[model samples]
Target: MSTDPASTDPASTDLVSTDPASTEPAPADRARGFEAKPGAIGSPPQHYGNPLHEQRLLAEGTAVVDLSDRAVLTVTGPDRLSWIDSLTSQAVAKLQPGESAETLLLDPAGRLEYAVRLLDDGVSTWLLLEATEGAALHTWLDRMRFMLRVEVADRSAEFATIGTLGSPSLAPAAPNGIALHWRDPWSAVVTGGHQYSTAQRHPSADWTYSELLIDRAALPEAAALPAAGTLALEALRIAAWRPRRATEVDERTIPHELDWLRSAVHLSKGCYRGQETVAKVHNLGHPPRRLVLLHLDGSEGVLPVHGDIVLAGDKEVGSITSAALHYELGPIALAVVKRSVDPALDLVVTAGDPAIQIAAAQEVIVPPDAGAEANVPRLPRLGAVRR
Candidate 1:
């Protein structure tokens, strides 16, 4: 699909600029950096509770997160169902009211452009994607419309997306036994006592007490709202072992490499651009690497940044992609380690403090027909061989 670079907002650009104020300061400025500004990279205001830590707290308690960084696209038309199903990996045509699915929009080369959560509100389907790739996803969908009887528009400015986390007692109950209500990633149950509407536009109109919206000029005020930043969110994801599009994926990464096939890919779906490669990798080949979670020995020093190597003595087994300190779990990280490594083996993060420690990541099992093979990489022997 053809993308117009001019369509993006200036503030949303991912490229680090040369502006003195924007550039990361030197090592001498490390201590002062946190004190410098509230919104600096790796440093958000304390009110937000460190984006890395907030995600964990949100899971344990009630928290409202500003997901304005996600881009929204609205598709409406008589043929919208067919149009979307032909492009994505999920069965979009069959999505019932109030249901959502995570799907991928792939490039011609089978690489991912953006992974999105699609919410179907009966009338129109909303595609929520990473804020950084919003414009690109919009343009790609628009260009693919060609002669299809569907209309796709970027509605990012018109609607705001916020994430709410809490217990069944804290969130409003869902109607009609539809226990799963899509606010974003987490599901909410609308209680029988309250007459709730699943309409996105009327989110505030019906859910009086438990609703929030995060926009450019507007921030919702609620008792459940936690003051957290990106770092806290990263930490929580690490604890849950949830992967993000940026830290866990790139052009070289495939869906199975990060175990995305579990949620994002549908094996039974009809042919799509990247279906062949996905099938080949699943049935005939193993993912070159695998994603794993690491518990760092924080007492050693600071955690390493993304792409830092993981070592088994002199051998590089993997690289750390995401890391954060959890209030409960301590310094933890997510890494794409070599499948060859034994999950029980101890390893070391080669960045930050030399004394940092990492244990084998816990693995979540995938379904048999999903195409993952049993012939995974084995970890090297650390001690004396018996035979």
Candidate 2:
């Protein structure tokens, strides 16, 4: 359905004027947020702007994101904190009122199930995740609650979560400091608290990265806020190198492989499902792959697609998971490279119309005693263990 700007704001000059029937579809449906230009692959509808461009802007300036596509769940009761802490990767029990953390739900094998942002709002806790998995995650969490006093309810339909990308000064104010910065790329600011199924349209309202909870009755008012489609959101995500559940991770992907352990996994927290795998991988074995940032030499051609092979010399070292023509960084991407691949070596993505050149990611090193030395076996030379 076409969005009505007048229904949202009588004073918005930024609204694009068009006749619903006469508006020919652009190469990409700039309205819904898809990158489906004539020859491009179909993508989710757009939200605010190009999510990738928004992410780049967020890094250099500020941008708003519509996270309505993200699903929300509410857990209430005195035991909410303790109950949730027993399930996810973060130390949810230690979070004070108004605090938030980024956490993960893992499968039995320690592979990722859902990555979420947990917000403690004094009386209840909110879990925000990608909308695609909201229902399943809610059911999973509900089933896991055996004797805990907490009540789990899927609030996805009730709340519309928005995301803002930029520094704190540009973000909306929260009485309890900027809604807790759980990871570098994410923050959670409660919009409607426990208010269920509300909607409202606010002309002056900026729905960028802020989650706005409105009752269904308030949808007209909520639509008043600048509406964004999904394409813009995707662009923003790629720019930040932020990985989502379905696009970047799958059933066999571990938290460490996605750099999630740095932000989502609490190294000192008590046990939870898959904790043993986390501990074993972190303490004993080297993760098979590592997520890295790629600066594609745009001079070649368009960006590559997911699963595109990354080559170093003639050896395959990694595969690209996400790529975009970043407004600021040219063609940039995120890739999962073999942990054994030398960081100094130059790589190339073999996917785009013309191969895109890739540079090694900036390596973040660990202190000497962080854990046992990584156990990636060295490649044997012609006849010796030496290169």
How well is each residue in 47-118 modelled by candidate 1, as lDDT tens digits? 231333455456555555444445667788778877888786655678776776777766666666677787
Lowest summed-lDDT stretch of 10 residues in model 2? 190-199
Clash totals in order: 27, 48
Q: Model 1, which residues run further than 4 Å from truth?
A: 1-57, 167-218, 222-224, 353-387
What are the per-model C-alpha RMSD values against the true structure? 13.8, 12.6
- Runs of candidate 2 with Cα error greater than 4 angstroms are 1-62, 166-241, 352-387
Question: Can you write out model 2's per-residue Cα lDDT over 148-196, one digit (the tens) per residue?
Answer: 8888888655555544443333233232343423233232222211111
TM-score of each: 0.69, 0.68
* Model 2: residue 249 alpha-carbon error in angstroms: 0.9
